[model samples]
Target: MGDLANAKNGLNIFLNPLYYGKINDNLKKQIVKVETTKDSAYFERIENEITDELNKRLSGVLEDYAEIKGHVSSFQSLHGTISLNKASSLDMVHGKWATHDDYIADWLSGLKDSIESGRPSMMQKIFKIQRIREYVLLFLERDFYRHYKVRTKDKPQENLWSIWFGSETLFWGLLISPRLIEDNWENKPGRIRKVEFGYWTIGHVLKTGLVDPENNTIYKFRDLNDFLIFYESILKRVSNSIYEKQIFAFYVDYIRKSQNPLLEPLLIPEFRYEGIKQKHKYRLDFTILNCHTGERIGFELSPQSTHMAISGIKSKTQTELNKDLALKWGREMQKRNEYFQQYGITIMTFTDDNLIDMKNCFKAMEYYLSKRKADRQSVDELIQDIISIK
Candidate 1:
C-alpha cells in the first residue's frame, strides 16, 4: 500500500504541468524582486503568470483537471453541509421561515400531523432549506471553493496554483513554516512555547485549529469564512517577523546574483531532516540544493539566546540548556555533521551576526562554493599522482 501510494505520487509529479518547464531561475528572480520591493501588486502579477503557465501547459489535460475539480467541488459542498449542520440547530418556533408564535404553533401542529401520517415533517423541510443556504454561502463566500467555481476571475491565483501543484511547489514551501510559537497560557509565567503543526499543505487551511493551552482544548474554525479570518490574522503576524523575512530576502538575493549554475540554490524554510535510526525528524532553519551535483547544503540561523547563551535573558532549566548546547556544539551537531558527510553534503552554521550583515552571508556561501571547487581540484591531482606512481 505504501509503495502504491508512492507510485501514485510519483506519477502525479510527472503529470504536473509546471514540471514540464524550468521555473527555478525565473521564480527565484521574481521572488527576490517582490520581496525586496514589498509590493503586493508584484505578488499578484507573479501569481497570475504562474497560473497562465500552468493552464497553458495543462491544456491537453483539461478533461482530467475538470474531473478532479468535480470531485473537489462535491467534497466541498458536502463539507459545507456538515459545517452548517454542526453550527445550526432547528428551533422550529424561532426559525427564520416562521418567526411569529402563532405561525410556529400552526407549523408544529402541521408537522406533528405529517409525522403521524408518515409524511416529511416541516422540521425536515426547514433543515433542507438551511442546508441549501449554507451551501450557497460557502460556495460564494469561501475563497477556496470559490476559486474552483470561478478560476478565470480576477482573483489571486496563489491558492489555485497550490491546489494544482499538490501543495509541494517552491512558492508555498518557501513562504510557510511547519512549527510556530504561541504563548502557553497554562504556565503561570506565560512562557512562549513552540508548537509543531506539521506539514501545512494547501488542504490544511480548510480545517486548521489552534490549541487553547489554558483549557487544554483545541478550537477549530466554524467554517471556511471563520478559517480565512483567523488565517489572515495569523499570516500577517507571523510573516512579518524580522528573522524569517530577512532570511528569505537574503536567500533570494544570493540566488539571483550568484552566477554559478553548479551551486544552484533553493530556499527550503523549516526543512525536516529524518534521523537514520531514530523515528524522529529535526527541523533546520533553511536548506539549499546544489542543482548540478544534487547535493543538499543546510544553513541554520542560531539566535543569541539559544546558541550563544548571552547573559541577562531568562535563565533556562537544565534540560533546556542541555538541549540548546547539543544543538549548538554537542551530540546533535556531531550527528548532523556525520549525516551530511556520509552523503557528501555540507552543513553551514550562521548566527544573528551574519543575518544582520547579509554581505557576510554571501561571503560565507562564496567561501563554501570555492572550497568545494578547490577540493575537486585536489582530488583530481591526487588521482593523477596515483596513476603516475602506478
Candidate 2:
C-alpha cells in the first residue's frame, strides 16, 4: 500500500507545473529519496520540527495550519519571493502574524504610556513580546490558508487580504504597548519606529512589529509588507528625487571645493545611470545631504540618518518638475548612500522643507549622529535612538 501511494504521489509531483521543468531530474530523484525513505526517518525529522514550531507558535487549533508542512510534498514560488529558503522546499506559510482586537487595545494603551514616560519596563517588554508573537503566529496561519491549502469549508477564492491579514496589527499594537506613557491617540507609531526605517531588504521580520528589548528584532524573518516598505523607502523615490547619485557627487565636489580643494571628488557619473552596484540600476529621487562631514571628524554622516529625501513638492502646484525633482532627490540619497556605507554611515530621508524644518528632521539626523559617536554599530544600534522619538 505504501509503495502504491508513493507511486501515485511521485507521478503527480513529476506532473506538477511548479516542479516539472523547473527542476532537473537529478534533483527530483534526490528529493524523492530524502522525503520518502523506506523507513520514512528522513521525512519525519523535518515534519516533527515544523509541527513542533507550529504547535508552539499557534494559539488556536486548526489542522490546516497545524499539518501544513506534512500535506505539501514540496513548494516553490519565484514571483520574486526572495528568501534564504526559496531554492529549497518552498514552505513560507510560516511567515506573517495574527492579532486579536482586545489585546491590541491594551497594547496600544501601554505602548503610548511607555513612550511618554521615557521608560520601557519589563511589563512593557512583555506586551511587546506577546503582541509580536501573536501577530507572527497569526500571519503564518493566514498564509497557510491563503496559499497552502483550502479550508474544509472550501471557498474557491480568498476574501480579503485584510480579513485574513490584519493591516494594522502591529501598527496599532505599537500604539498600545504595556507602558503607561501618554501620547497622541491617532498616530501610527510603527512607521516612526527604528526598524521600520531600514533601507535593506533584510526580510519580513522587521516588517511585522515594533522590536523591543524582548524577542529579537531583525529583518531576517520580518513580514512581507514591512520588507516592502523598507525596500520601497530605499529603492523607490518618494518625491523631488533626481540623479540622487550625481547630486551627492556634486555635494562631495562642493565640500572639497570649500574645504579640501586638493582632495578631488569621486567621479562616478557612470553610476548616475548605471546604478551604484551595476546590476539593479534602480534610481532614487531624493537629495543626499552628506552629513555636514568635517575632514577632522573620522565619520561624520550617519549614512542611516543624515540622508534626506523630499517626498512632497516644495511648493506643490502638482507640476511635472516638482514631482520629478522630488523623485530625483530620492535617487541622489540612495546613490550617495552606496559610497557612504563604506564609512559605516546610513542615509536618512527628509523632505527639503523637513530637512530645514529643524523640528522634524533634527532627531532623524541624530540617529546616525549617535551611531557615529558609538564604537558599536549596525542597524540595531540605531533602533532605540530612532524609536525613542516618534
TM-score of each: 0.29, 0.16
Give the whole-model CA lDDT for all candidates, comma-separated.
0.38, 0.29
| Tens-digit lDDT track of model 1 for 312-378 | 2367777776776565577547647764754444677777767777567756654443333111222
What's the distance in Å from true for residue 257, model 1? 3.7
Highest TM-score scorer: 1
Backbone collision tally, model 1: 0
Error of 2 at 329 (Å): 16
Clashes of 2: 65
- CA shift at 188, candidate 2, in angstroms? 35
lDDT of 2 by residue, 224-265 (tens): 434334323533332233433324333333433443222221
Q: Every model's Cα RMSD, please?
A: 25.3, 24.2
Indicate which candidate wins on lDDT.
1
Please list all clashing residue pairs in model 1, or write none if there are none: none
Candidate 1 displacement at residue 3 in angstroms: 61
